[model samples]
Target: MTRAHGEVGDPPVGKYEEPATPEAAADRVEDVLKLLEGRWKLMILFQLFGGRVVRFSEFERAIPGISQKMLAQQLRQLERDGLVHRVVYAEVPPRVEYRLTAWGQSLCPALDGLLRWAATRGAPAEGVSDS
Candidate 1:
């Protein structure tokens, strides 16, 4: 059966029914959420949003109390998800910098909205207030 561009599956969701891509585009949102599911993803994105491309050590310092292993795992996941770009510079000690990808930057607005909502919604029942 013929399918239109940017459409997925047979019979389509409406007037369009293009074949799904090999990369599985349907799970993009879920994947993005999963990428952000970690404790440090949002914090990392926030740091990157400030227009600072930070070296590996600097990134670690920005995230208080985050374990080195967790940071490494989250950074690897972010890299795999195309949400962050890792640049390696050839120098003594081999410098590596991390910055958000375009897709990652797009998430800033949504994150901000979510933050605002949470601010008004208050903390969870079991949550402790910082103040």
Candidate 2:
């Protein structure tokens, strides 16, 4: 019942810690960044977002320059991390599909904000401390 990231300007609510020590805050952010460490993981997740359920082969077509082996590996890792849900169906030819779990979908707003911030692409103002 805790949120991945709260609404902008909203005070820390639910299980969120308030004014965490800088060290603890950095550590927590680092943990989230680690979840997206792999090269194709983000791309794969993006494909599964938007309520789109993608078949195994469809991923190959969606993401260029990714090998089938690499695609499977990334999907498996995402699934293990509880971010991607995989469904398999028995049929004439076995079928598999991938979609983001609610936890994964919750990342949309945060990532959308990050994307918009990145689009700004400007240097920090003069005299701003790195800290």
Candidate 3:
């Protein structure tokens, strides 16, 4: 059977290689998980997935219960991780906006899948309150 480009059964070519050991694979997984380890990161990414540039104050208003300080900190972390791009405009007020980078856009499919699974299972989607 022919495997799609990144499917598990696809053969590794070029720079890519199977992990030397299962422990090495686990470590790689841990590293990625560590990057995304936070309450706000996923939600922040979800918001950016709407394909529009978002501003600092916009995030504050969209996400309930998120403080200004926390939102700033999380956006910084995402930018450092190369997932989110921050554009600062030179102006009196210093306008700033955030959007997902190409690397970050790659995450949309996986996130969409997770959302679909949650819906099928009757679980609440993000931003939806059970109450």
Candidate 4:
């Protein structure tokens, strides 16, 4: 039996390939980027990376300037993409919290490296702070 590595469904250890052209490579990166492309998606994921499950309002607050509508949209997209999980608690207030899925959690190390590199560069991505 072939062992599944993780969400991408690759074997335990394997190489991933796509069409070799620059455009193809770009497209492939864009595809994965789509999984994290929304204005608040990465921020949301980053906020949840510390194993802390947070409510939607908490997510909005953590993101600073993101609107509720955009937050909802981004969360929905992340949920649909299978990178984030929403858990609802049955209670009077009906609490709900968002956390990263296995795939999303796996991105932490890579994201950390990217953040470090971006910090060294002059212009860091929005939502990512120099401080």
Query: Against the hidden true structure, what lDDT does model 3 obtain?
Result: 0.78
Q: If the candidates were sorted by their TM-score against the true structure, best first, what order would they fall in?
A: 2, 3, 4, 1
Per-residue lDDT of 22-66 in model 3, one digit per residue for the tens? 999999779877778888999899899968789888898899999
Candidate 4 lDDT over residue span 1-131, tens digit each: 12211332321235776678999988977988777776778888889897778898888767899998889888877777777777767676777777777877888998999888978877767798868
Candidate 1, superposed: residue stretches over 4 Å from native: 1-29, 122-131
The regions of model 2 sitting more than 4 angstroms off are 1-14, 123-131
TM-score (all chains, Cα) for each model? 0.66, 0.80, 0.73, 0.71
Which has the greatest TM-score?
2
Local distance difference test, candidate 4: 0.76
What ranking of all candidate models by lDDT puts the best one first?
3, 2, 4, 1
lDDT by residue (tens digit), candidate 2, 1-131: 22221111221237766646988888889987887889999899888779998998899998999999999888877777767877767665777778887888888888899998897677675688779
Model 4 earns a TM-score of 0.71
